[model samples]
Target: MRTSHPLWPAPFPILIPEPRGYDMVAKALTIAGSDSGGGAGIQADLKAFSAMGVYGASVVTAVTAQNTKAVTAIHPIPDDIVAAQIKTVLDDIQIDVVKIGMLGTPSLIAAVADALAGYAGPVVLDPVMVAKSGDTLLADSAIDALKSILFARATLLTPNLPEALKLVGEGSTQAQAKALLDLGVGAVLMKGGHADGEICTDLFVSRTGTQDFSALRVNTRNTHGTGCSYSSAIAAGLARGMALSDAVGHAHTWLHQAILHADELHVGQGHGPVHHFHALWK
Candidate 1:
């Protein structure tokens, strides 16, 4: 044990041992909330991280009494505790990328932004405003705080159609993507799940240009953690040294498969989760 005790071996310098489980492994950190239902939030993030072959760490901003059907209650973690979690994880782990989701309050957003001030690694911010069950996850008042505090620090912003409309006001997806880029995010992933179309086309919009990643829409109600898993997979790709566009492309393709196989789980009565281990499981 690496201990600090006045009585123990302080007179002689102690040899620090190498960190275990960090050799040549991609690492990712998730600063988000927890979902007890094991579908969304930190659960989904970790599942995606593992599926993408990245080591995952977490800092829980809040805890939700959530299930497939609804988020009945939420209790935000204390601001200091939240900050401590982020700081401790970052201090110990040389994380390649960070993913943030479900910051329900202005205080939590500010804490996360401040905690991540010196981190120069890529960050994927999934602005989780609402739940799959139509329950509001973020405070309406926290929208401004999210933009002002964390938007610029984020390498990519993954927002579904409804969230994009909420963030940038009424507009076409293209316009909303542009507006998000103007807000200082490196890029905006305009997710097309909610859009009515046979193909689910996600738009990658940035200052450079735009590209679309299209996949056949799988008809499945068991897509509860789509946003969380998608963002985490992108983070995992970045952690493994993939380019931004490549990461997005891989995540899009991976999520489609997960959604297509989601019905296999039979997790809950309402809005079951996508199969995070779709590729690995038999």
Candidate 2:
């Protein structure tokens, strides 16, 4: 019997489409919150994924009424709903990389960790403990939950100075990043953007070793979403099959450009977002 349907011709073409410019196209998933302000969290993750040439997917764990100025409110989604979204996506998509951010509660943290446990892929854990405006994002109890659950499962842990301080303890320095590697984190990128200096040097520490990546700090006050952007770019690179060190290198490249171009635009009443598409437009 000849299978004939209105939707398709009697004979479909068997030739598959050619691969794109790169050797592969990576698909990445972001499990985080919706930034109504559109500069951080899932919003920044998606933009970073797109700008870095990866397919982007997301599961929103919470919704925030926030802007560049501050996070006004956060409504955490139920654990079951968060799990369902993750399951649905994993069941259908071949997610190459996973970027996690802004899990605001202990329950949500456990749920995300549980869901991700089934998929052993490259994972980037951005410990988003506080907002750019210094508003607390993760609950006091949730920090412990994140350490026990998400931090151990991640392939790369990306934390800013404040987040690293919270996770490891206050007075933590670049030399102390290795201690986090001992805590079961496969790798760690301690972002130097928060530190006071003429050159922002991000320290990449891993079981193999430690390396420093620095750039002349762009003298712009509009540095909102910088951490999220950097972490998401690394996830994008991972999805594209880059090594951890190489991925971080690529991410730093993207971040440096984002900061340099940031001076050309303004988005809010306070700290503004990076220019994610600076290279593309220029």
Give the top-scoring candidate (TM-score): 1
lDDT of 2 by residue, 4-112 (tens): 1121112211222233455667899999888898888899999999987789999999999999899898898889999999999999998988999888888888888
Task: Tell me the deviation in Å of residue 152 in model 2.
Answer: 1.6
Candidate 1: the clashing residue pairs are none
The TM-score measured for candidate 1 stands at 0.91
Q: Write the per-residue lDDT of candidate 1 for residues 1-282, one digit (tens) a residue.
A: 111111111211112222335567888999888999999999999999998877899999889999999999999899999999999998899998999998988988988888998899999999999999999999899999999899999899999999998898988888898899989999998899999978777888877778888777788899998999999998988888887887887777778778888999999999999999887888
Give the deviation of candidate 2 from the true structure as CA RMSD: 11.7
Q: What stretches of model 2 exceed 4 Å from their correct place?
A: 1-24
The list of candidate 1 runs beyond 4 A from truth reads: 1-22
Colliding residue pairs in candidate 2: none
Q: Please name the candidate that would achieve the greatest lDDT relative to the true structure.
A: 1
Task: Give per-model TM-scores.
Answer: 0.91, 0.90
Model 2 alpha-carbon miss at residue 266, Å: 1.9
